[model samples]
Each structure stands twice: as structure tokens, then as C-alpha cells.
Target: MNVEKIYQGTADKVLRGIPASSGIVLGRAVVLRNEIFVDTHKTIQNEEIESEIKRFDIAKKNLVAEFEESISHIPPNAKDLKAILQADLMMVEDKFMYDSIIKFIKELHTAEAALVIVFDQSKQLLKHSTDELFRERVTELDNILKRFIIHLSKGEKLSEISENTIIIAQSLTPSELLKLIEKKVTAIVTEVGGITSHLAILTRSYSIPAIISLKNATHEISANDEIILDGYTGHLFINPDLTLYKFYREKQKRIAEHIKELGELIGLPCKTKDEKPIQLWCNANNIDDVKNAKIVSSPGLGLVRTESLILSLNRIPTEKEQYDYYKTIADTAYPMTVTLRAFDIGSDKYADNLLIHEDNPALGLRGIRYLLAKKDEFKIQLRAILKASKHKNIRLMLPMITSLEEVIQTKKLLEECKLELLNEDETFDHDMLVGIMIETPAAALIADDLSKICDFFSLGTNDLTQYCLAADRTNESLSEFFNSFHPGVLRLMEFTVNAAHKNNIPVAVCGEMASHPLATSFLIGMGVDELSVAPSLFLEVKEKILDSSFKQCQKNVSKILKTAMLKDIYQSMDV
Candidate 1:
């Protein structure tokens, strides 16, 4: 039911949060208390309005100049990092955002208050989005605003960080993060960062162990205090006892050695001890994911969620825009397979118009049901995916599919789009493989029917675990109830794999469980052909997989599945 590593020794305290990166590190805690600013009703005098507007303009110009300088200093090889900096710069110079701020300033609001109005307005709109990507955009924009405030407040730049310093911060701006990377801070702990947030993603790209969403991080961990950060397990051991300190010290040493060897795994086939070829597909949700996972040879993107690209521009993108965006992704991971899962939006994702209020939208209209209900809109996405598939490596996957009919209708629409493209003489992959996500209970129950249609089956166990258990994983109280390794869930996974195999189709686990360290061996035993793992977890998952043998894991699965208790199932996989 849980994979957190619990040490048997005492420590001053161990704080648990979500891991942003993966590694074990012992460092001097360097508390970074950035000045916090909030929206206020403070109004500038009429005479101060023009000066405030000019101050705002000057701040924007300075921030833009900082991004440009950073981008320039970036070597030619780090194109992705440079591109990220450029994107932040674009946000700094966004015309609409700038104009709105100016209008607020003209209303006599101070430059700081003007920023608050504009940033809050934009963030509030995106917060209503059901998509995680859209919600994460709020964090990205928050960083942009932080930069602006720092410039306007006449704040000093970050001081140089010494080696092996664990950064404890309230929240980090993008520029501060870049500077920390330059200084090579040992670890990062932030009070307000989600796993998908910009700060967390950037930390992982640099391979620094990070614990985000760690409340009271700055208050508890003072500068120069010795600490152990467990990014692999989401625990921060602050001022630990001697025993705990020694354990983590050795643990850090072992992890460093393992990470060093993981680079050698690049270009090498991921086969188990028994020589069972294990296909590890990376989840390329963003450019950073692609860049981090690009080290692996012939790296296939198991899941490419298109929610951000669809919703980012504040309007639904044209087919051409989607094509250009998707094509760049496929081209970046060129020649390697890219499984494009069409918008999995529902009330839980970005479905503003799809549903107003339902008792429960997850169980209601979402996924394939939502797409099917909006065929015309769905066709646009389908055509864009198809058009982007001219590379011949792109395949389509349907999310939240529970029926044979949904797959049939989706395929029919896809064919119609293909015909339209053909008529227009536009190039696309006619033979692109189509798949379905086995995330619903009904889908698993009728895997035989679904397998008959789908070229592949990707078990989205994150949702499957939630739906099968009838527990909302997001609901904190339901945490203990949402166990993915439960026998019932295991049976569904086994059944789907069997069905896919019966139809001679591949089955990939594209859910959180796929990359989960404890579940790696169990999944390998269950006979899933591929695991679409988070790139950040790639090294750790690879290490576990290499230590496992298919025959041993299969035998273990047979014994583990026969047990009905979740505790026993987890205990068996704990090894």
C-alpha cells in the first residue's frame, strides 16, 4: 500500500512531501527566505500614476534583459534550457498581460498592486481548468510575477551557494532556480511546489534531489544545519541522530554510485537478469521530459498528454497549430515511437463546457465519452494527431475508453479525418496504430472486446486504481484505500495483458504504478510488455528491473495474487 522507506532509528523529525527529483543527499541546509508580497488595496496618488507606470515598464525591461543574458550565456548544446528561458522571457513580454498591468497602474494602483491584479486575474482563469498542465501554468506564472516583484522591489540577487547546500525556500523564481543550478546546490526543498510545477520539473532535469510541497521548510531548517533529504522516498530528515545520519550517509553513497552507473545504461537494452527484454518508454509530457529521457537510445514516448498545447493559448488551437506542435515533439523524439493519447479531459481535466456540475464527473462524462459526445471537436484533435503522424512513428491512444463501440466510433472518425486529409492531399500516416487506455473497470472486464480493436493497451493504473477501489486518490482521507497493487486491481491488469496477448498486441503500463519502484518487479512478473515511466524515475526503476528476473518475478506474482489482502500483496512486493 506504501513504498516510503522507513528507517528504524530516531531523527529530530522527518517531513514527508512529494519528490520532485530522485536521489539521496546529505547537505548543509541553506534557508532561502524570499520576501513575500501579496495583493493589496494600496493605490498610488494621481501624481504617482505616471511614475509608477514608468517603474513597471522599467521592471519588465530589466527582467527581459536578465532572461536574454541568461539565454546567451547558455552553451549551444543546452538548447532545451535556453528554450525554457526564452519561454519565460516571452511571458515577461506578453502584450496582453503587460497591457492589463498598465491599465491597472493607470487606475492608480501601485506597480506591485497592478501586477497582483493582472497575475491573479490570469491565474484565477487557469485555476478553473480541469487539466493539471493548466493548473501548473499558475505556478509558472507565479514565478514570472516573483521576478517582476524582485525587480520592482529593488531586491538583491541570490548570494552564491556553497557546494552540498540543501536549499530551503518559501518558493523559487525561475531565475533563482537557474542560479542555484549554476551553483550546483545539493538538494532543494520548497513550501509551494507541485510535482508538475516549473520549479520541480527544473530540479529534476538537473538531477538534484528535491522535496517540494514541504511546508515550514524554511522555518525548521536553518542555514548550516546538517540534513538528509530523501527524494526517492519524499522524506526530509532534519538534524538526524547519529544512527540515522550514518544510515543515510551510506545510502547516499550507494545512490550516487548507482546513479553514476545508470548513465551507462543509456543505449543499452533494458533486459532483466534472466534476459527478458523490458521496454521502458518515457512519459514525455513536456520538453524537459523529452530532454531528460533523450539520453536513452531509441527512447519511445509511451504517453504524450496534449492538454497543455490544446489549452495554453486561451483558445482551442487550430489543426495546423496542433500539427506544428505535435510534429516538433515527434521530430524531436524522431524515429522513436510516440503514443499520442488524445485529450483525456473531463470534469477532472479541462472540460469547462463539457459538464457544469455532476454528482461525480469522473464516473460521469469524461475521457472517450466526452470525446464521443463532441465528435466535431474531437475530429479536429484526431485530424491533428493523424497529420502529425506522417513520421510513421506516431500512434493514437484513446483515454477513458470502456466500450467496444467507443473505440469503433473513434476509429471511424479517425478514418473520416484520414479521408479528408487524403482529399486535401495532406500527408499523414495511413497505417498509424490505434490503442485504448485500460483505466476503467468496465474496460478491464471487457478487455477481450477492447483488445479485438486496439492495436495496443496501456493500463492507466492511476485511474484504474481509483475507479476500481471507488476511492478518489486526491481525497486525502481516501489515501489508504487507493491501493494499486490490490489483488482486484492486479487481476484486471493480468486480464488486460492476457487479452492483449491473445490478440497479439502489446500492453504497456502507462500509469504511476508502472514507474513505482515496488511495482516494477510485480508488473514485470504480470507480463506487461512496456512501462511508460516518468523520466525522473528512470534510473531508480532501471536499477530495480535489472535486479529482477522474469521467472522469479512471475513466480512471486502467482503467490502474491492468490492472496486477497492488500497488506500481504504489498508486503510480498516490498522486496
Candidate 2:
């Protein structure tokens, strides 16, 4: 119901900008801006100076954390984001700059006010610089700090965003763009960011329709304004006429036809060329995804991200609230089954009480670790999941499992929840399955032991590859090293899959590896019992396996397993 049909989408009044990505898209607009304007100067009381300085220090620390979080979002424009990020820090740490800020704070200005004065003075000095690099850095520094200011302002604008939407911003960062991409934002327009800058080139690499350097785009484009963007020509039209509307609407249909074609394959029997049946499941985080999965006729959900369903409010949801939410999806996919993973918090995500500062969050308390640490909250979650299992179709999955000891501990807790539900006379499924996500090297290394104690294993290849290769995708220096097809990563997958099968348990590839074009057939050959992917790519992945003979896939897997180079991995799976 939140979805807007793009067929009626159009644009009338035109505005010119720099074409960043080459594509055409029509959709509604969502304008993003900072809640606190940078230019505002607030005089602080002399007595409040101490607290103000502390606030500034905290904000500066948060600024660095923001930059670190952007690591995973480095774009095509910044081929070496690690170095670029270092340069950004050096600019902020300049002696004269931080000194000027302190000087302003002594003059009784707020932290943001002090920053603005120093920033303007610095820019004035560089205004006439003949060095092109100096001129460019000035612009980069301003954009980076302004975004940090927005963070300091703490405005997360309405969390409810719909599909086929275009984002217009005073300025945008590659990290911001990546987050929106996850929500299926159709296009982008921004007042700042150059065609060669990090934000612009990223849009190009992602094949999204976008334009940059559109002056005052955040003001010119209002929210919900139906607009047409010609990314090839750097033009945006607002409130388009019937004629232009019809033209773009027809073009939109032609473009969407290919995607629609893919969905048609979903209803067909899923199997390999040899008639070996395989399960193709879809992943969902909300109602829209559930609806899309239903349309594609996904057999069931392989991953139900419970956090996304509840954490948008950044608070702990009540047990009834969690039950209603999970029950909706479980009932919708009834007959088939839905696997609801417990709140996988940590990293960039937090749920109220779970919010805490960590120098390295990704490797810190997250996923099942967070849940086990917060046992009372964990019980509320388990009880809700159990309460929703009245249809006998909802299962529980634990993420970030690193040991059989953790599995035993979780199993003990799950049993407690089941008993509580029975004592309360709650209607529930007693046979609900519990599984562990084999994401860590430690977990995969002990998959044989885990299989003996767990109902199933879901290979979270994204984390597995990162852990196995000791590579972080955000660190551009390790771009080549952060490969999903690295031999070691693949070997781990094979080892875990074999362990699960030998123990008479099912194994699934539920990460991006399942949906990768080359990896799909190879995974099929590797003998994973199921492949779980986003609903949008469900049918396409299913078709990839259907076109592959099990024998050929087995052969491809055999050849690729022995390859030493990345190029050879591709060649082995080339056919």
C-alpha cells in the first residue's frame, strides 16, 4: 500500500545539473536536510563553557566514528578510500583549524558556531589558491564536516520511505546513498557533490539514475513531487505535462518489463536440469518484502531480519507487538515456513538499551552475543516467536554463533520459553526448529559439532568471507582480498555443507553469495540444501539453478575448488 505506481509518474518544469549516472527514472521526491543549520551562531553563557567544551569533544569523536562507518560505503570515485579517509582526518586535525575553534569557544560561541567561523576563515584563505588540489580539498572538507554537523543535530528524518522514490539533498555522501539504495530509492539529485566526486561516481557504478551539482535541489524539489530524471542529459523535470508524462511512462513500462519477466519463472517447479529438487527461499524485513516474496511464490523465508521490523523506532518493542509483526509474515507464508532470527543488534544498529560505544563494533558485542548478554530481552523475543508459532510455520535462528557452547546455552533458554508459553496456556507449535548461522570462522570450523546439536546451519557467506580472509570490504586497500570467491571461503562453505548433510541436517547459503551470478550455480553444485536471497532476485537465482545440470555444477565446483587465483575461480565457473 505504501508503494507508488510509476506508470503515472512524470515531470514538467525542467532543471539542469551534472549527469552522474546514465539512466532514466521517474518517481516521487524525498528531500533530506540537516535539522541544525551550520551558519547559526549561538552565544554561550560564560558559566556553561565547561559543559560546552565537553559537548564539542564528544561531537568530534562522533565525527571520527561517522567517517569510520563510511568505510563500507566507499564508492567508485574513491578507489582508495582508506587513504582518502586519512587525508580527511589530517585536514580536521590541522593545528591552525582546531586552534581557531578553541579561540572561538573562548569567545563564548557554541561548538557548531565556533566551527563555522573557523571553516569560513579557512576557506577565505584558500579561495584564491592556485593549487587545484588545495581548492578541491577545501570543498571536500566542507562537505564532510557539514554531514557531521547533521549527525550532531541528530535528525533521522521519517523512517517510513517507499519504493520508486528519488532523493534530493543539499549534499549527499556515498554512505548515505548506500543506505537509501537498500530501501530501493530509485534515483538521486543533490545540490552539492561534483560529477567526479565520491557521491556522483557511486551512482554511476551502481547503475542508478542520478544527477549531481544541482543548485538548491533540496529547496527546488519538494517532498512527494512527481518528477522525471534524464540521467543521460542531467535534466530533472517537476510536475510534468500529460505529453511528457505519457512518453516517460511508456519508457518506464518497457524498462520494467524485463524485471516482470523474471517473476514469471518463480511459479515453475524449482529444480536442477537433472530434476533434483532444491529449495529457493526469499529474505524479508517488512511487509512490502513479504508481499513481494508472495508474488514471486518463494517457498518460504530463509532469513527474517527481526531487528529491521522492530528497531526502526530505536526502542524495545513489546512482546505483543513483536508477536503481531512476526505472525503477519508467518501466516502470510503459512504451509511454507518462516525463520525469524533474534534481534541481530550491534555494528551500526542498536536497540535502545543495547546502545553503547565500541571502538570496533563489528567484532564486538553484536547478533546473538547482544541477545545472550541481555537475557531478559532475549526471553521476551523468544516467547513472542513461540507465541507466533501457532501455525507451526515459524522457526527461530541465532546469528553470529561461534561455538557449540553458545548453541547449548541458547537451546536451554529456548526450552524455558517453550515451557513458559505452555504454562500460560498459549497456543504454539512445540516442534518449531531452532538453527544457528555459521558466520564466523570459529563457527564454520566447528560446523560438524554444531550440526550435531542444532536443527540446521545457515551459511552467512558475507561474514564468513570477511572472517576467513581477514579482509574488511570497507577497507579499499583490501578490495582484492575481500573476495566472496576466495578459495578458503569456498572451502569453508563446502566443509560446512558436507558436515550438515552427514548429520542429516539441512544447510543453506543465505547471504549475497546465494544470489551472485557466478556463485549461484557453483552453490547449487556445492550441494547446499537451500539458497536464500532478496525477494527481487529470487526468481533469477532459481532460473540460474534450473538451467544448470547437477553434474555440470558438480564439475564446475570441482575445478573452482582447486583454483589458486581469483581469475581462475571465474574461469572455472565461466560456463
Candidate 3:
């Protein structure tokens, strides 16, 4: 039946959230009720610690086996899932949790209560730990307690469900969700989760529709109600009218078609309608991302965030290790360019080992400032990049350089690093291209001078817009002012791009703004040399370039930048 013929339903309140992943799919609602069990304590003699340990051992073995089985079913290409499984394996024999359980058993003498205390302590531990490994370990421990509670309460095994169900729950531990590997589970909806929560990451990896932070989701959603989930819009509908269903169904079809077309376009050069070549680059964080880029036929790596590598290491990676990692990408790309941004740490992404904190991290010591404070660490990274450049096409971009003085100071440090390498008789490329991120208004204003020293400029519009408008993007209260389409922001960007061009320096955009299709044309029209976006968006943006003309984009940009009102600008530009 056509959507036009479907009966209309009463409008419901619409809630909004950030779309972490993009897609459209409609499936049956499989409401998952989170099973919570109370722990009972039993007193055991100290002599029984060994016996208790044995019981714990057996439980862990069974749990590990279950998790392994689940991991085996995950596609080999699912790096995110594999990483989660690795975390589970790392935490399987957690010494602290096991010892705590054993101690509780010996002191209180009750296995059941000891198990309860262990589970509770584990949850507390997970709360304190930001490492995905530790969190996954806690999830594993929680699963054990859940099953034990179920068996103690004489509850039935979790019912095997069909694939088209939307799994609803108060919270889902990674282990529990992974175990339900039957393909029928089409979507996940949880009442609890932050933006960076494990469930959110899993949902993104699986390409499933999810809604989190719904305080009343578990209680609000009924079992098996025909539902529609627009993950792109973060909207959940119960018994949606036929019109809505038909609309989304067609949307789903179009999305599938678009993805297929993009896949086909892989390996082809990205060119505009006028045959002007635009560099289509991918943002990569690690070796896995580099590998994934090749799979999607991305021509180059735009931004290799070094912070991810540093955070993953137990200690600071040696210069050699860093060089190897950088070299791998450089060699792989060969002739293709890779712009590795210097560690851009601040706010939510600082190295734990460094222990650097600030009153307001966003505005405080971060990016090049933090690196400058720790000169030795910074030099090691610089030397590594310089050495790697000997082998492949690699360019350096400094992050958060607010003034030309910072750029001058950074170049001095680079010179010192180069001298040290030379003294060590290290044969490396000293002619590597160097650039700076134009993220702040001050940087944009001084772009003319900065362009003289730097080889290129990359406009980080995400932070540029935030700083220019004096509004934090993360703050929902000031979202109105955080508009990227604001005339002020576009003017600043235009000025920076013009400044870079006048100096014969190419300018690229590697911000979230660049990923928007509407903004993509505007950026091209503003004389952006390249567009660095998420790998998923690479081909789509390339397609838009092929379909659009520079003249039309220039006209759009002119209209957009004329209006002071963001909403009016967006409306006029059809954005």
C-alpha cells in the first residue's frame, strides 16, 4: 500500500540526539527488559578460599567461552567488535575483582553475598575507569552475576528472539549484547548511555538504529509494538502510521542505493563538473583506519590524530615505534598525501600518563601549548614524523596555534629536533611540508602572516565557529549561537582561504562542517583545495562535487554569507 493512503496518527513529542551513525532501517520492536538481581551473602570459613577460587575459575572459564563464541560469529571486518572482545578477554581474570570476591568470602563466609559485593565493587571500578578494556571487563563480571542471579531465582533462559526486534533495555552490558548474536536483533534502544558509552559505539559499528538517554524507555515501550526508528533523526515511534512507515521504507531504499553507488565510485578520482580535481581524504586515527581507508579506496589520509596512538600505549611510544607507524601509512599512500596533525589533546582527550589538567581544559593548556610545556615529548613526536617523511609523502600540521608567535616557536622546536636527528647521524627528510590548524579567530585574522611560514592551512571550523561565536558546541543552552552557517564564521573562513591562496598555500577543511553535503559545495566555492571527511562520507561528497558547479556554489555561498540570521541563511541555501 502507498504511504499516501495510510491513516494518520496523532503527533507525539519529538526528542532529538546527535546522530553518531547514518542509515535508515525499519524493524519489529523486541523490548529487552534488563534483569536485575539482588545479591545474597553467605559466610564461609577461611579454609574455603581455595574452593571459592576454584568456583570463580570455573565461572570465568564458562564466561570466556561464551564470549569467544559470540566473537567468532562477528564478521572479521568488524574491528570495533573485535576490540570489544579483546577488552573482554583482558578482563576475564581480573586480579582485583577476583581477590575482592575471595576476601569477601573468607571474611563474611558467604559465597552468594561475596559474589554480590564483588559485582557491586566491579561496577564501581568500571565507573572510575575510562579505559574501554576495564569497562568491558566490568561488563563481563556483571554478566556472570546476572546469570548467577537468574539461576538462583529459577528464572528461565533469556528467550531466543527473532531478528527484526528492537532490543530495549535499562542498560545492556557488552557481554550480554554480544551473546545475542542471532541476526534478528535489528536495533538497540537503551534507557542509559552517554555519547561515548560502549553501547553507542557498538550500535555505530553494527550499523543499527539506537536511541539512548531515554530515562523512561524500559517502562515506556511495550513488548512487540510495531515501531519505526529513525537513527538519523534519533526518533522512535510506536505503531507508526502507514504513511510514516512507507516514507521511511523508501528512505531506506534510497540510502541503500546511494551506498551502493558510492561503493562503485571507489578507486575513481574525485573531480568536479568542470573537471577540477578535489582531493578527497579520510580522517584516520590508527592503523586499522588506514587499512579501512584502502578498503573504501580513499586516496589519502587527511588527519592522523596522534593522540589515539599515545592513549593506547602503556608508556609513551618510542620514536622508532612512532616512526614505524607513520611510515606504514606514508608507504601505503606512496604518492598520496597524508597530513598528520600534531597531538591535539585537551578537554576529553588528554594522555593519562601525562596527568595534565586544567580549570577549563577547552581554553586552557592544550594542543601545541601542552606539547610546548612538555618539550621532550613533543620533540620525540616531531623527530618521528620527520624520520618517517624520508620514506613517503607526509606533511605536518600543528593544532591550536592561536598566534604567529606560536608558529615561530614551534618551528624553532622543529629545528632543534632536526638538529638532534642530524647529530645522531639519522638520514631523514628535512624538507617535509609544515602547516597549522586555523581553529581560532585570532589565527584566522592573522592567516595572511601565518601563511608565509606554513606550507598549507587547514580550517578547523568546528572549533573556529565555537570560538568565534563564543559558544561551546557541546552546550545545548547556547546551540543557537553555535551555528556554522553564521555569516561571521563564513567570512572568517573566506578570509583565511583567501589569505592562504594569495601566498600560494593550499587550504583544506577537516572539520565536521566539511562533511555536510550542503556545506561541501560552499567550501569548494570558497576556494578550498581539499575536503577531509569521515570515510563513510567520502564518496557521497565526491558525488556532490561531480554534480555541482563552482559557479552555482559561489552563488550559494554569496547568498548564505549575506544573511546575519543563521536560520534564514540555512533556509536560503537549502541547507
Candidate 4:
């Protein structure tokens, strides 16, 4: 007699992966269980050692060429892929990895085993390293190995474990993850990573449902097991009951409908029901993001982070390259305003061979300080922005400005750059507007004085809230004080906006605070002229603003300011 399986056992020790993006997907699990193998050709005669070494050299050259060729075909629109290729090339040329491979080949007596041993050892080191910097280095090394392996395996028999699969692996490098086309792989689940990890960022970029840090996911999930993945709520159900299945099926239908509705909003004006027009803008890091902004009908680009371009290149981008990049976005946005912020680098984002230890990096030497210290580099960026402004609507903004003196010095530097350009007969937009980000309390309090010199102000509430409340949002222990609606924060914002308006300067809010549905109304009432948020949240925020009244927001702000403590203000307001 034959029997059919109805249910599987419960996953008692199952660890769940953190969802990076949202969607429900069901598919067979493809287990890419990789094992190192050594392919040894027949032993060459003693006299062939010189020829063997030459062959290994040729193989290395050909391998690198092949990788470059494949990378060239990756869409220029894929910023994540571009970043991975940049990092991978660095790894291939790293002295440490190269020396290890050479030593292995000389001692191990075969090129194939030598390569495998070097890769295996590097992988082991990556798994064991406690230092984050070392771990990142190892991750890059593993990327090189995986790419080389895949390059060799091309056109060969690839064991397809299943069709319409979800990839379950220990951890996937960016290159490996990119190689899997979206149609075949429904989702990606890994055993390690936080939201900022490369794989997580890439998954979010592609709008794919990904779950990370699921310990032993590869061991627990069996091939071809019908499972339900809830990316929104980070839930996984294995062989769910009939009732649960029906509920998820209904949920899938609702999600599809909602997405369709959001699609309809594309290219529509982001105006409130009362005819209050809000400038819906997109935060971009590269030209691809600029293109995405056009698709979403973002009226402008709020924050053009230039760090992505700098990090992707082997060396700092030349003035001409930077000019072209900035110009591309400005020309694309055309009449819409494009605000480009100077490089914001510090602890985690330090340039090569320049290290600075800080007890609290968020408050340490970053943003303007880093830029000022490297005057030449800072001037180059300013020159690029000035040149780009000649063709498009461009605004230059300084980040992490805490004092009036920093603003004065930055303005002076800009003047010097302008004068130098004039001497070189290169015409620039001398009348380009300059702005400063009010992220610190000191900056907020002195906005009146700063506004006298600067053209505009943008409130970075993410750091401002953290600084005011003396709470690190990353620390779960301080979760109670991370509230943005707190009386203290609201009061500061009110003061900053009032100060800017008092001096006849426009103010905008560009942070997580601006994207919140309830907070958007409050900000507009606080006398802010603009609210810049991500493109994905544009329609929802617009809907919220249309449903709300500016009059009510002002009334709520007044009530909150009268309260004594931050917590009391939050309790009084509905938000």
C-alpha cells in the first residue's frame, strides 16, 4: 500500500530571517550546497615546471578578463551590481590573497588544489573573524572566489535542484546573489546579516523579498517543501494548515490590489485635497536613482549623496567625472531643484588608510569636519557642483554643520573655488544657492544667524532627535526616548522653522520624520515650506496630508509645546 504525506513535523529550533523587503512568495527551495573540489591533471614532467607556472599565469589573466567581460554586460542602471564589481576588482588585486595563492601553488605542487586551498582558508577566516573590517575584507575575498568558480562552471551542467526556487544558503555575496535572475529565484534567505548588509540592500533595490539571519535555515528547510513566506511580517509557515493557507491566499490578493493602486498614482501631482502643493522629491545616490526618480514622477531630487560614486572608483573621482555626474542629474531633473550634499564620511565610512577611533562616531569628526580637513578634496567637489549648476537647477548643501564658524569657512572656500575657476576662464554659476543642514541643537538654535549667510536650511530630524534626547536609536535600551513626537523635539523644530522664516529663508524637512504620515501634517503646520521624502512613500504621505488640515496641526503643536516633559506631549497628541 502507498501512503501520501499530509503534514510535516514542527520546526522547533527554526530561526527566522529578517525581511529586507515585502512580498509573499511560495516556491521550491534551491539548496546551493557548495563544496570545495580539487581537479588534478596528470602530473607534468619535472622539466615542465616553468611551463606550468606560465600556464597558471595565463589562466589568472584569462580568468580576470572573463570576469571583466561579464561585468561589462551588467546594466548601467544596476547601481548595486556596479558597486559589487568595484569591490570585487579590489579583492582580486589584494596583495594578501595573491600571496596566499602563490605560496599554495609553490608548496602544494598543483594549481587546482592550490586555488581551492587558498579559497577554503579565506572562507574559514571570514567565518571566524571578530573584527567587522576584517569580516568585510573576507567577504570581498569570498566574492572573488565565488565569481571565479561560477565563471569556470559556465556552460557546464548546473544541478537544478528545483524550478521556481527560493535560494537558501549560509550567506550570499553580492555577486552570487546578482547572478540569480529574478524570474527563477522568488526570494533569498540567508543565515547572517543586518538590514544594512550588502545583500539586504541589494534585495531592497531589486524589490525582492529577502529574509536574513535565519540560523540553520539551510539545514531546516527541505527541498520541494511547500512553504509560505510573509516578507512584510517576517513570518514563515511550513506545510501550513488549510485555514492558514486560505488566509494567506486572501492576503496575496489584497496586496496585489494595493500595488496596482499605487501604480496608478505614478505621474500624478502630489497635491493635497485642499490644493496645497508639496514638492515630492527622491533621495538619490547615482544616475540610476535619477532615472528612477523620473519614473516615479518625483518633482525633484532632495538628497544627492555623492559617496556612492567615490566609493565605487579605485581612486577619488576626478573633477571632470564629478562634473559630468552632477550635470547628468541636474539636466535630467531640469526645472526641478536638485540638492547635492558634500561628502559625509567618518568612522564607518573612512577613506582607505585613514582611521579615526571615536567613542561615539555619530557625534565625532564627520560630514563638514572630514571635508574641511581634506581641503583639496572638498574644493574639488565644490568646483564640480558649481560647474554642474551652469546647466541645471542645482543647490549646494553642507552636512553636519553645528556652528556659524563652519558655515562661514565653507562659504569662503566656495568663494575661493569660484575665483579660481574664473581665472581659468571656466564660467560657473556664481549665483548658485547655498544651504546648511540643521541636524544639531546648536545649529537649530542659531538658525537665525546662519540664515543671514546661507540661502536655505534642511532639517535632518534623524540625527537631531537623537542628539536632543541623548538617546542612540540603535540602542534598544534607549528606545523610550527615540520618539520624534516628543515635546522637546517638536519645540526645537518649531524654533528652527520660525527662525528660518523670520529671516526670510525657506526651510525643508528631509528625514524619516518627513516620511511619517502623521508627522508630515505637523511639519507643515510648524511653518516648514517643503517636505522631502523617499519616492516609495510619496503617494501615501500626500494622501495623509490631503486628509489633514494645517490648522489642526498648528493647534496640536501649540498644545504639545505647553507640556513639560517629552513623554507628556506624546500622550496628549494622537500621533
TM-score result, candidate 3:
0.76
> Positional deviation of 253 in candidate 2, in angstroms?
12
List CA RMSD, all candidates.
4.7, 13.4, 5.7, 7.8
lDDT of 1 by residue, 1-575 (tens): 34234553466666877777888888788888775566568887899988898898899889888888777777654454665676678778889998998898889888998888899888776555544455556777778888898889877557667766888988886677778878878889988765556677677667778988777778877888888898877888877888888888898788668778888776667889999999888997666567667866636999988865654554567778888888888888877899888887765443456456654555667778888887887999999888888879899989988889999999999889999999999899999999989998999999988888889999999789878998755433455577787788999899889888998999999877887777898899989999888776776677778888999999998999799987787679763
Two-way lDDT contest, 3 vs 4, winner: 3
In model 2, the worst 10-residue window by lDDT is: 1-10
Question: What is the C-alpha lDDT profile of model 4 across 1-575, one tens digit per residue?
Answer: 00011223332222355665668886666665554354643344556556656666666666577557647767766766666766776666667877776665555346555566777776664433322223455555655665555544442112453346788777776656655652457888876665446776678777778887666777787766667777765556665667657877899999888777876677666655556666667777677677777777777878887766766664568899999888888988877789998877653353462556554555666789878877888999999999889864899989989888898899899999999999988877888999999988889888889989889999888778878988754333454467777777878888988889888998888876787655776776677777776665566666666666777777776776788875466455542
Cα miss at 331, model 2 (Å)? 2.1
TM-score of every model versus the real structure:
0.80, 0.63, 0.76, 0.71
Off by over 4 Å in 1: 1-10, 35-39, 74-87, 102-109, 160-163, 241-249, 260-277, 285-295, 305-335, 343-392, 420-430, 440-448, 462-504, 534-540, 551-570
Backbone clashes in each candidate structure, one number apiece?
2, 2, 10, 0
The local distance difference test score of model 2 is 0.75
What's the distance in Å from true for residue 567, model 1?
6.2
Candidate 2 residue spans exceeding 4 A from truth = 1-260, 347-358
> Pairs clashing in candidate 3?
30-166, 32-168, 40-113, 41-113, 42-109, 42-110, 43-109, 43-110, 44-109, 163-184
Give the Å error, residue 66, model 4.
8.1
Taken over the whole model, the C-alpha lDDT of each candidate is 0.80, 0.75, 0.72, 0.70
